[model samples]
Target: RSNKRLVPNIVEPKIRTIEETVPMADRTMEEILQEPTKGYGEAIVILEILAENFEIKTNLLQLVQTNKFHGFERDNPHTHISNFKRMATTLKYRDVPNDAIKLMLFLYSIEGAARIWYEKKPPNSILTWDDLVNKFVNQFFPPSKTTHLKNEISRFTQRFEDTSGEAWEHFKEMLRACPHHGFSELNQIDTFYNGLNEQDQDSLNAAAGGNLLSKTTREALKIIEKNHKFVIQEANRMFLG
Candidate 1:
């Protein structure tokens, strides 16, 4: 399971004094005739996230282990970052610079393809916690997933047996999973309204005083949410029997 060291020690000739560091165009014929010694610049670099000074508190490893990501398709990068932030808040590392602790701890919080992806980023490319998080979520949560979830939201419909409250809650859950779904509140309301069965639409229209569309966006949402709450309340009361 052990991989070969990714970096090898370098030995090079570099005695370029200020006099020798003259511009190529200014060099004499003898200097211009010299062969190139250092073939090409490096294509890889060590992570800047690891370059900063940091002291990992004893508890950080325990917290990181509890929420490690293994690069599975089902893994949620957003939720992982959210939980990591909460765990980091409880960490007590004195003298460490702000954001350094989170950057350091984030390394131990992933493995497999996730770790490889992090290690492969350009050095100094990740300057702050937000930068790192944006890259991570984009890589793991991908645009394809967002499109699929948005389609689901656009086609949301109440089931034959489920109550209006349950259908509303389910639609909300889909929205939560795709935070970048890009649908506005009005579009969401219109889509859901059009998707519902005739009876439910009539019921909502009645609840909204004959015309849900006549209400403001906020008013229409409130009317729908109120119905959801009313259904929930009535369902809870059924246990009393």
Candidate 2:
């Protein structure tokens, strides 16, 4: 028969080993590049994806230590180091390796200063990221400045004239400046809501229709968005009248 050649292919089906059944885990960089990511701003979207992937891929890696940079600012070392610490802390939590952290720090620094600093380093001398951090801190922020920054952070509040969104941003910045401070969530919401303009506050209150203590900052923001439209429409009507 014409099909006789195919019929003699096997007496029984082959049994696959565990290793044979398992799919290959490795993927080419090209394959990853070919995958689509959704968002506005190509650079930002790609960076976000890379950051997320880095977090996942490096989750099991040991914490890699490096020399630290204290920070450098002649007039206000407190502000400089505060920003530096934020970046460093974020990277640490994201599981970034120390060597990469140093590179990132350098990349983020002012172009001319970073270039000069890199060029001035002793030839072939090893400086850890920790060492870099310390050198920066000592060079810029002394003990007195550090104390002052802490006091400033504790006393920070939104100015009465600042917009609700601006007030929220300032509040977040303050929290970042003093993360260990015992500021409660309820207080934070109250502070933000209280700082808003009277009209905006009324809109948020009406939209929420209950004690806003239960709502998160994000939820409050959504209520503002929903109510702000009516406020704007009313203002337009008054202007036309």
Candidate 3:
């Protein structure tokens, strides 16, 4: 130990001395009260649950069985909302407004950014189930998804190995995905007929005993179903008989 008195060359982190800083302007009690004080703010949810006397108690554990939604792009908000509605309705609660039970439980169902979004909602902003659903769908399901789905429906083509039955099923799936695809029933039938490759079209035409497109929409649908059935029966006969 050298007696050279080793001292730390470090500067300590400091509180500002009164003399080193500008004084907060002298504030009267009224002036001080008028000044906005920094506060610990709690985030508020938008949903307004109207309380009734002896409100039915909702089970949070059951609400969570549907799984947490994190506001991901790939996740379907519409499907989640639908599933949530089904799960919520499954729980029995007497003498309570059904929407009240739903509004309360919906908050607990979401997590991550989805919960954050719910928190940021203005108090009393969402009063009904439809309000919550529309906002959620608009936020998570982008317009681009709708556009992609519509395009898929409009440009639907048969896969190389898909049977006519498979292609027809695939076309129906596109319609289900974008139910608002703006195509009329006739237009849908026409699009499906035109989408098939020549080989499949011949199969459809042969099953129909003429040009399938010349038929009425109802007739065309019947033809489609019959064609698929005939194809299946022929395959079964060849393979099984």
Candidate 4:
């Protein structure tokens, strides 16, 4: 039974790599604004890369909200809001199929609206960047919205399955696998609980009276300030480097 045959070990074949070109870094914001269509596409590509590299969605959203494209002046808040809204709409309606278009439309609409809401000073409602993110996450992935989009995409994909059918099916599967559905509920609950805890802590501090800080607490505050400075420096390095 021993040494009767030699067996060959076969290595698995590598699948073809999909090479997605990351947008250029050297292009100034001005260059991007000059022709918004290409520039906006590049901007989105860059944003996606930044999100992946940094693993920080909040920071990425802040960067996008603050970015001033070429032909767009910085700190012109109105222009920035307008440009973002236009870009969002454009991306929503780009030559993609109807199902994809609808999904993009919903995403961009909520995110774009939230960005505008966040940029307002003395906002009618006190909504922070975190608030915006929380709201979008909730609305998009809620059972009602998610189920509707799923059914719409299912029907749309089925209708076109005969023409480039494989691509349509693959796209639908990708949509089904998106993580937004799961994260939406958790993020909303976390935000709610965190806010409640903060309010309770503040109330307790107020009830304690006495300058809201004893000598020990004052020393703790100093330590926190020092730590915050270091944290800021680290964040800057991570973001800009």
The per-model lDDT (C-alpha) reads 0.69, 0.45, 0.65, 0.33
Q: Return the lDDT, model 1, position 137.
A: 91
Candidate 4 pairs with clashing backbones: 29-69, 29-70, 30-70, 30-71
Which segments of candidate 2 are over 4 A away from where they belong? 1-127, 137-160, 170-187, 196-200, 216-218, 221-241
Best by lDDT: 1
Give the per-residue lDDT digits (tens) of candidate 3, residues 44-113: 1222222234332335444554577888765678767777877777655554456655664676568788
Kindly report which residue stretches of model 1 are placed more than 4 angstroms away from their true locations once superposed: 1-54, 90-97, 119-127
Single out the weakest 10-residue window by summed lDDT for candidate 2: 38-47
What value of lDDT does candidate 3 attain over all alpha carbons?
0.65
lDDT of candidate 1 over 24-142, digit per residue (tens):
56656675456222112111212222223433555666777778987898788887888888887776545544455566567668889887786567533565677888899999998
Q: List, residue by residue over 1-241, the lDDT tens digit for candidate 2.
A: 1211000001121111223221224545565346312111011101111233343113211221122233334334345545555555555534435444433343234334533454444422223455555655454555665566556655555577755455556667766654344556665566667656676566567678864545787786576555545555765789999
| Top TM-score hit | 1
TM-score, cand. 3 vs. native: 0.65
Ranking by TM-score: 1, 3, 2, 4
- Best of the two (3, 4) by lDDT: 3
Writing each residue's lDDT as its tens digit, candidate 4 over 1-241 gives 2222111111111111112322446567787556333321311111111111211134333444455333211122333334455544443222323222222122232234443432332212212333333444453345565566445433332223222223333443534444333434333222322323343334334444532243254443443344335546776789999
Error of 3 at 90 (Å): 3.0
Error of 3 at 149 (Å): 1.6
TM-score between model 1 and native: 0.68
